[model samples]
Target: MTDENTADSNTSTGTNTAEEENQSELTAVRYADGSLGYPAHTLGSDGNPPVDTIDLREYTAEIITWTKATATPPGVREPNTLAIVEFEIDDESVRAIGQVTTTEITIGDRVEPVYVSELRDPTAGIREPDSQAWDGYRFKPIE
Candidate 1:
């Protein structure tokens, strides 16, 4: 562990021990931040900062990776679609019209409710109702 103090820099340059001399392509990017090691021509994405420096570990060569963001935002609001509320005999209670806090499930979409009939202990979660449940509820798709 005594050598751990300078392990990273040593491992990164350990190739110096090779018998045959070869040009090395790995070089650390020099930035105001002396810890980052960005590669040449590596363009940073929008809303992200560019890497501009390499940090040498004291005893071990640590490798790092970077990539672009992967998340896509849901599209504009579907005015008619309502987030789920409780279901009753004839229809389900939706987040009422223009309620700021409520987001609704698209009418055709299924969703889980927090609770159903307490006494029956029916599953509160959204379920693909079977033919019997559909027939009992008279479930219909809204235009």
Candidate 2:
């Protein structure tokens, strides 16, 4: 699975085959100390090494908060809905923030990560379209 948490080789360019195939995967870091963190870290928060890598997409999360951004950065959609959700994985809590699939959501709602080919229009940004990747996962509320 391609790690979608950080700017790795698979995500550095928009033309990468993995990205082109929409193979992005949301990953998290698991520390030896039993702590979990989003945006996978090279080292643990305690300064130790990571014990495992987990796919956040495999789990469901609870929306802790949400908001809509009317004034967004270039390439992002206007009135974009975003949320902070927490996942309970192996008795550990991992929180992540990302775009929401819809604005019709509330705190405490259950959500799952769904891969999207583009989070925003790469051509709309100041940078060259091929300079970076555009694919990522969005939070979708579960029924």
Candidate 3:
């Protein structure tokens, strides 16, 4: 693997190969100050940072810790309690909450990233349970 730090710089026009441009977009935000943001999926509802989407790998995780929700946040009534999970992504760890009914998630369980639709139940009265559905990343244990 070519070390990106030591990779040859285009001393001429200052551009790399065409294949590099076609590769998956890295999950980083370059600041005007020449600093790089964290490489992570912008899948939070907090509206803090990383307002753009980032590339994420699927079916490549193992659960490290999990917490089963005991109570709904405030307004929701009949919504199911999701399991908040922290899992490994390469050497880095990522956290995402996932829906579960019959199966229980445990540490070290092989998990994978899954895109779930936003919970759209009018009866429950919770319009946005977590955040925008497509922006959220959920995980499921590999069967």
Candidate 4:
């Protein structure tokens, strides 16, 4: 992945050009009250509008919990491992849940977001492939 630190040149626009070029970067919402949230919220926890956005790919998060799902939604992988991770940004904690790249993770393990073109086989689902997005980020244990 490209170095996120070098993407600072585009901060004036509130958009990271480096992140835009890197699909692995996870987009997160930044609230006006100085809080961050994943899955990008339309409104803040305090009911205020978002102030800006941040790329979670620039940060490394710690695993809080994990589990394996044997019964998954259609098109998703069976026995897929998922984890809830916490990222510390500006002294605040932002938690998100996503699939793990592998099952070799544990609590307290550090992870980084990696882009997956298709989290599942879209065609394998009941709905039309173009009806919904199939790409997403996955957590990979950091070396």
Q: Which candidate is the best by lDDT?
A: 2
Off by over 4 Å in 3: 1-54, 74-102, 120-123, 126-135
Tens-digit lDDT track of model 4 for 43-135: 988999889888887889999999989999988877788899999988898999988877677799998877666778778867898875576
Clash counts per candidate, in order, are 18, 0, 0, 0
Which rank order by lDDT, best down to worst? 2, 4, 3, 1
Q: How does each model score on lDDT?
A: 0.23, 0.80, 0.42, 0.77
| Off by more than 4 A, model 2 | 1-22
**Model 1 over residues 1-143: C-alpha lDDT tens digits?**
01111111222354544411332222334333322332433433332344443321111111121122223222212222222222221121112111111232233332221111111112323543241121001111121
Candidate 4 vs. true structure, TM-score: 0.77
lDDT of 3 by residue, 1-143 (tens): 11111121212255845643443332433333333343553333343445443244332555655555447644322344355555443344545555532245567777554432332223344466444222223455566
Worst ten-residue run, lDDT, model 1?
A: 134-143
**What is the Å distance of residue 17 in model 3 from its true position?**
31
* Candidate 2 local lDDT, 5-120, one digit each (tens): 22222223536564446667688989989999888878886899888899887899999999989999888877788899999998899999998877788899998887777788
> Which RMSD values do the candidates have, in order?
27.6, 7.8, 14.5, 7.5
As for TM-score, the candidate ahead, 3 or 4, is 4
CA lDDT of 66 in candidate 2?
Answer: 93
Stretches of model 1 off by over 4 angstroms after superposition: 1-20, 33-35, 42-59, 62-143
